[model samples]
Target chain A: MVSTSILPLQLDNVSFEVRGVRLIKDMSLSFPAGPRTAIIGPNGAGKSLFLRLCHGLLKPTSGVISWATTEDLNPSDAQAMVFQRPVMLRRSVAANIDYALKLRRIERSERIHRIDQVLGRAGLHRLKSQPARTLSFGEQQKLALARAWALKPQILFLDEPTASLDPAATHAVEEIIDAIHAEGAHIILTTHDLGQARRLSDEVIFLHRGRMLERTPSPEFFTQPRNDLAQAFVRGELLWWNLGKDNRKNKLKQSN
Target chain B: MNEFSKAVAVAFQLVLGLDHQLIEIVSLSLQISVLAVIIAAFIGLPLGAAIALFRFPGRMAIVVFFNAFMGLPPVVVGLITYLLLSRSGTLGTLGLLFTPTAMIIAQVILVTPIIAALTRQLIEDLWIEYEDQLRSLGAGPGRAITALLWDGRFSLTTAILAGFGRASAEVGAVMIVGGNIDHVTRVMTTAIALEVSKGDLALALGLGIVLLTLSVSVNGAAFLINETARRRQS
Candidate 1:
């Protein structure tokens, strides 16, 4: 189990720009522990980029991303990510997990123990000897999660963990993710699936055009969004055109 | 047609009977080429992996240079090796000129760039697919390169075999550096060249058959390895 110290992540006016085009606008937000947070936005909203930034895969163009943890502990060691399209090494499923543990310098005996545990949890134990690349997309995602889980990370960042999966596969992946979270890893995910965000996340961060428009509890955000854009998004209406006209219409309709 | 048929018949006889002279030449060719490939792999794999993984000033120039060098002429490599090892030249006291070692060195010079260039291409493609995950896993560049090289083992094996093929088939470099000395440094390609020139068509045709068979076998093995790896991946 992870220590309780690395609970919250603080972003102080963090911005990320690539090739002079800003993708993540200057935004200050804090993610406290104990609740799963989901960053939800439309296409090109930089949700994945924001998750990558928080995971330290990309350096912020400016400002700071700080984890509230001890100075001596390397933040990366305590965090892991499962990419939208998880990259599996061309080796056995078991070897993939072993590779992660080996990187962390985990001892061989303990690695075997952890590998067995995570494979069982992810329901991949029976396929441990199969080549990882040969696994189906859903099983590969579970293996990716299992590989990360083997490291015993305190925080796990998942980027659209079930975006490409079918409904059945998505449900299985979600169950595995929930199992990991139950095992004490903080879950931070980005998705465009409103239902998935609502079902899995405790809080929602709604973004539009590289800017954070709303941050609220998932239940409240879906029902009582604070911003016009969030409300439009919740109602499944496009928010990019003629905000003034749309806003007046929405407001009149709400009053009625 | 009759002469060619007779040559073919004689060649088969030589092979089936295990002629000592023919065996000696084939053994020498294999020895020199295999040793050259070993040396080239030792140098080329790391150099290629480094170039693929790191970004530095002049990296593009180096990559382009090595890519072009993949087609380096064997005779030119032989000429350079000759100049280096000839008496009154640099390190002339070593007396390596006209020796099998000199031929091996020439072959290494010719093959290293091919292996390195191919490895660079294979590793670069792999690194693109692997960079995000590896970086997220806290892998430094060296660790990432090591992991990629290991994962790309089958492809690297093909690259090494490519180097071996180039080394084994080349005659210009070995002939020039090795001098085709009888019972000493004579190899298949050089012997074939000598035999053809001396109008010994039967012997030349025999060696030619052996050389062709070896090339086909090497390529067949590479294809098999690639197919097996693909099946495993799928």
Candidate 2:
């Protein structure tokens, strides 16, 4: 939302490990400004781990993740993140936005204006004075997005922002994410929901077993995956350890 | 049974009539204990929060030290304070011993570690839930501690009350340092101890009743506040 942007985020052979088990293995990718990107993978695919490393919430065990930084700006100042389960401060809905803004060191009057503007846009104006934690699950997620929206972050990292929502709530959240994207902020999110990836992303990065198997435009990637594992994933066939489970179940069904 | 009933009668009359002597003891007790809890919170909450937030070479040892000191015997604290304030001792020139100031100092010393240790625990739990979001928002260590303390304020109130509980119920430290001088440093706990030693059963029972009521009232307030917070949080 500013004249200058922290775009073209580059990751060069980055790998993350914990307790001797690698979660994100030797991933090197470049994310330019414009199109929304979704990292799609099954459970334990290290999608969230990759997102966290890029967000600077965790350090890579090896290699480098860097942003195009300006001399005057801290990389953190230009980005914000919304977790799967949003954390609400024990305060009013308005104050939650205010707190994030205050941390950004925005002036008093600007904070008030931003809080007012964001809550109004997010349909949270009616709940402005209500305690944030008391909000229902769907409403809490929306509030989380609104809080991040108030920051006017140049890049928003959403870690499965809609993973735990009902249909109506998911629709609303997708709309909000699109709205944020339309406002010229770069979007990077991780989702296991294939339909969500198809609907929300311009490009898809398929991850399997801590590795990037493919990166392609959303439609072409879904239609023709280059990797054999990715093709099986696109075909809705279980692969890896899950393939063994699927085979046993099929064999038992045949016997029965 | 007859004597017990008579004691109960004396306690009720003293409480309902708001006896001047009882009021003096209750007022002085509130003054010293409340002041002690306030000062302790200022020092202890930050100390606990810092310990919870930062990592150093001997961090675990410092944490264990404070946890052990939460149960520090009041007599030991009293003796140490007495020595420090004695005429020939290092801080003796200030001449604080045997005064209400000395009693307040003793209570502060007794209460701070209780507050610090409890706050360390509360803030540590909160930090786990908040670390990712806080770091993503660009908050450094100092900001994280402040934000966490504010969020955990509801539970921390009880921790502070625990500190107040120690301060108000303690007699040994205040007794040694204050000398229990009437119209000067006599508080409810020390007065109760004195009247019991003198075999003034009626007055002792009366003061004991007042102290119990005060304790229950503070705890009740803390409960009500937490209940309200829970409702709002849900």
lDDT tens readout by residue for model 1, A1-256? 5454565889999999999999999989987767898988788888999988998888999999998767567788888999999999988999999988888888999999999999998899999999999999999998999999888888899999998899999998889888888988889999988989998999999988789989999999999999877887787776443457667677647744
Best by TM-score: 2
Could you tell me the C-alpha RMSD of candidate 1 in Å? Answer: 2.4
DockQ: which candidate is best?
Answer: 2
Off by over 4 Å in 1: A1-4, A69-71, A239-256
Q: Per-residue lDDT tens digits of candidate 1, residues B9-108?
A: 9989998898999999999999999999999999999889999999899999999999999889999998999999999879689999999999999999
Q: Which stretches of candidate 2 lie over 4 Å from their true place?
A: A1-3, A239-256
Question: Given candidate 2, what's the lDDT at residue B84?
Answer: 95
| Candidate No. with top lDDT | 2
- Report the lDDT of model 1 for residue B101: 95
